[model samples]
Target: MFTPHGPSLRELAVQALSSVERGYDLLAPKFDHTPFRTPDSILQAVERALSALGPFDHGLDLCCGTGAGMGVLRAVCRESVIGVDISAGMLTVGRDQEPRPAEPGPRVAWVRGDALALPFGPVFDLVVSFGAFGHFLPREFPELFGQVHSALRPGGRFAFPLPAPAPPSSPWYWALLGFDTAMRVRNAVWHPPFVMYYRAFRLGDVRRELERAGFDVELYALPEFGSRRDGSPRCRMVVATRRDDSSQRREASHSSLAAS
Candidate 1:
C-alpha cells in the first residue's frame, strides 16, 4: 500500500512497464513515502542488532535506495558512510532526501554503480542492504555476494534482514505467488523487462551461495519480530563475514540472468 504522496496508480503502471532502473528512477521522488521503502521499525531493529557488533568504520549501504539502510550504518559505524545504487535518480533522491542524524554522525555520500559490478575496491568494513534482493535473480547471487565480498576489507561483514517465507495457507503466500506470475507474464509480453519477484530468492540457496563465496555466514534472530508456528524467527538478519585473506574468485560478468 502507498501513501497519499506516493506514486499514483497510473504512474506505477508506467513504471512497471519500464526497465527496473528506469522504473526506480521514475519512482525515486516519492519512494520514501511508499510501503516499498524499508520501514522505520525494520531499520531500527537492524540498527540495534548491528550496534551490538559496534564501532564499525567506513560502512557501505549496498543498493541504498533513498538511503533507507544508511541510517543503520550511521548508528554503528564510526567513520564515513557510502550509499551505492544503480539508479541515478534514486541516488539523487538518496543524497538529497536522506537526512543526517540530529546528533553528530559520519559523512554520508552516494555512488551510482551496479551491484553485480561494484566499482569500489576492498575498503569498507561493513555493508548493509535493505529490500533490494528481489531485483536480482537467484543465479546472480554469486556475483552479487562476490561483489559485496570484494568491496569489503578482510573480516568485514555483509548484512541484511531476511523475512521468513509466508505460510503455505496464508494469503500473503498466495499474493506473492500471484505477483510473481503476473511479473513473469508481463516480462514475456514486454521489452526491457521490469524484474521483481517476491518468491525467487530462496534462503537455503542464498546461505549456500554465501558460503561458496567465502563468507562465514551466520543468522541472528531479530527478537523485535515474534516467532512463527514452529518457533522460528519471523525475521533473521543474515550476517556474512568475508573470510580473512580469501580472494574473491567467482565472476558473473557473462552470466545470464534467468527470469523466475
Candidate 2:
C-alpha cells in the first residue's frame, strides 16, 4: 500500500512497463512514501544487529535506492560511506534529500553503478543491501554474490536482512505468488523486462551461493521481528564474511608443502 504522496496508479503502471532502472528512476521522487522503501522499523532492527559488529571503516550500500540503507551504514561505520545504484534519478534524490546526522558521521557519497558490475576494488569493510534482491534473478546469484565478495576487503562483511518465507496459509504468501506470476506474464509480453520475483530467493540456496563466493556465512536472528510458529526467527541478518587473506595464504602454503 502507498501513501497519498506515493506514485499514482497510472504512474505505477507506466513504471512497471519500463526497465527496472528506468522504473526506479521514475519512482525515485516518491519512493520513501511508498511501501517499496525499507521501513524504519526494519532499518532500525538491522542497525541494531550491525552495531554489535562495528566499528567498520568504509561501508557500501549495494543497490542503495534513495539511500535508506546508507543511514544504517552511517550509524555503524567509522569512515566514509557510499551508496551505489543503477538509477541516476534515485541517486539524485538521495543526494538532495540526505540530511546531516546530529552526531558526526562518515562522509557520504553516491555512485550510479550496476550491482552485477560494481565499479570498485576490495576497499569496503562492510556492505548492506535492503529490498533489492527481487530485482536479481536466481541465476544471477553467483555474479551478484561474487561482486559483493570482490568489493569487500579480506574479512569484510556483506550483510542483509532476509525475511522468512511466508507460509502457504498466509495471504501474504498467495499475494506474493500472484505478484510473481503476474511479473512473469508481464515479462513474457513486454520488452526490457522488469525482473522482480518474491519467491525466488531461498535461504538454503542463498547460503550455498554465498559460500561458493568465498564467504563464511552467519545468521543472526532479529528478535525485533519476533519468531514463527516453529520458533524460528521471522527475520534474520545474513552476515557473510570473506576469509582473512593471511589465513587463506597459510592454508594454501600448507597445501603446497603437503603436495610436494
Candidate 3:
C-alpha cells in the first residue's frame, strides 16, 4: 500500500520493531507517501463539517503527524493553529514542507510533545486528530481524552472522523481481524512492543468515556462515504465539547472557601 517513494520492507520492519515514537520518527520523511497518512477525502470532509460548526479562534491538531490535520484547522479557525506530535523528526519534516499560502485564516505552528502529556493550557477553541488512535490501547483512552479536554477552553470542541467497521462476514473484516490477531501474538512474544489495536476503538465505548470526561458528545455522518447494509452511517464525525460549568463551579467553590 506504499508508494514507490515510501519506506522499504526492511525499513518498515525496523520501524515495527522500534518504540512507537522512534518508529514514527524513522517513518516521518515518507509518511505522507504511505497509505498510513490520513486520507485527503477524510480531511476535506472534516473541513466541511468543522466549517459548519466553527469560526473558531485557535485550533490544535493532536498527534498531527506531517501536519495534514493542520490544513483542516486552517480552513475553519481564525487566529492560529498549532500541531503537537511526539516525534521531533515528524515535526521537522512538517516544518520544512511549505504550508499553503497565508490568507484570511489562522497562522500555523508545530510543537513537539506527547499527546498524552500535552504542554498547552486551556487555550485552544478547537482540536482535531486523525488516524492516531490505533497507536493507543483501550486503557489509555480516558487519559488521552482527558488531555484533549484539558487543552480546550470552555465550550471548545474536539472532533475526529471514525469509519464504521466492515461487516463481520466480509473479507475485509476477516483481514482486519487476522491482522489484529497477528499484532496481539507479536506483542505477546515481543519486548517493548508496539501497541496498535484495531478492535479496541468502539464508538459506543468512546462516547461513554467522552461523557465521563465532562464532554457533551455528538455524532454527525459524512454522507460522502455512503451507508451500510443496516442503513447506519458509514462514517461519523465525533464532536465533543468541553464542560464550561465544571470550570465555573470549581472557580466558584474556590472563591467561596477563600471568603469563608
Candidate 4:
C-alpha cells in the first residue's frame, strides 16, 4: 500500500531484485511515502514512552532509514543524535529532511554503516530503531543486539516498539503469510537474495537475545492500540537497559565492609 509518490511497481521490482543495501538506496527518496516507513503514530507513541524514561544525553537511531526514529531521539535526547544506516542514499534524504527545532533541538548526524558492525563507542545514552528488523536474519539477532549493548554507556537504554501479530484467521495474517512464503520462494531461487523475513522476529526470541546480550529488558504497553482477544497487549514498547554490575557489586561490598 504505497502512495502516489511512492515507488512504482516496476521500481519495486527493480529494488526487490537488487541487494538490500542497493535496493534501499534506490528506494530512499520515496521511502517516507511508502508504508515501509515507520508510521507517525508509532513514532508519537515511542516519543511519549521515552518522555517518561528520559531526559537522555546522546541518542542513536540504529538502521535509521530516512531518520524517522531520529525524531523520537531529538524529542528526548538533549545533546546530539546520530542516525546510522547502510544506505548512503537514505542518509542523504535524512539529512535533507531534518527534525524540527524544539528547546535544545539535538544536533543530528548521519552515518552510513552496517548494523552488525556499528562504528561507535559506548557514548550514547539511548538507542532506538524502528521498522528495520525484517532486514536481519534470526542468527544476526545476537550480534546486532550485542553491538547495540556495546554502543550504549552504562545504564543507557535501547528501545523499540512492536505490534502484536494479527489473529491467525484474519485476512491480514494470511496476507503476511502469503507474502513471507513468496519471499521465501523468491530468495530460494534468486541470487544475492534480498533478506527480509517476517516470522523470524518473534518478541520472545528478541527478549531472550537482549537478555543474553546483557540488557535488562522490560515491556510497556502502548495503551493507544488497546488489547487482544486474550486480553494481552496489542502493542508493546521494549525498553532494554545496559546495566553496570561491577559498580553495583562494589557498592554492595563497601556496604558489607562498613556493616562489619
**Best by TM-score, which number?**
2
Alpha-carbon RMSD of each model: 6.5, 1.5, 3.6, 3.5
For 1-260, candidate 4 gives per-residue lDDT tens digits of 37889999999999998899999989999999998888899999989999999899999999999988888998899999999999999999999998567555778899998999999999999999999898998999999999998899999999999999888988988888888888889899997799887767899999999998888999999988899989998999999999786876797899999999
Please tell me which predicted candidate would have the highest lDDT against the true structure: 2
What is candidate 4's local distance difference test score? 0.91
Of candidates 4 and 2, the better by lDDT: 2
Clashes per model (N, Cα, C within 3 A): 0, 0, 0, 0
lDDT of 3 by residue, 74-152 (tens): 8898899999999998999988984667555668899999989999999999999999898898888899999998899
Q: Candidate 2, TM-score vs. the true structure? A: 0.96
Which consecutive 10 residues in model 1 have the weakest lDDT in total? 251-260
Query: Looking at candidate 4, what is the lDDT of residue 240?
Result: 96
Output candidate 4 Cα RMSD.
Answer: 3.5
Worst 10 residues of 4 by lDDT: 99-108
TM-scores of the candidates are 0.92, 0.96, 0.92, 0.93
lDDT of 2 by residue, 65-119 (tens): 9999988999999889999999999999999989978888899999999999999
Worst 10 residues of 2 by lDDT: 1-10
Candidate 3, clashing residue pairs? none
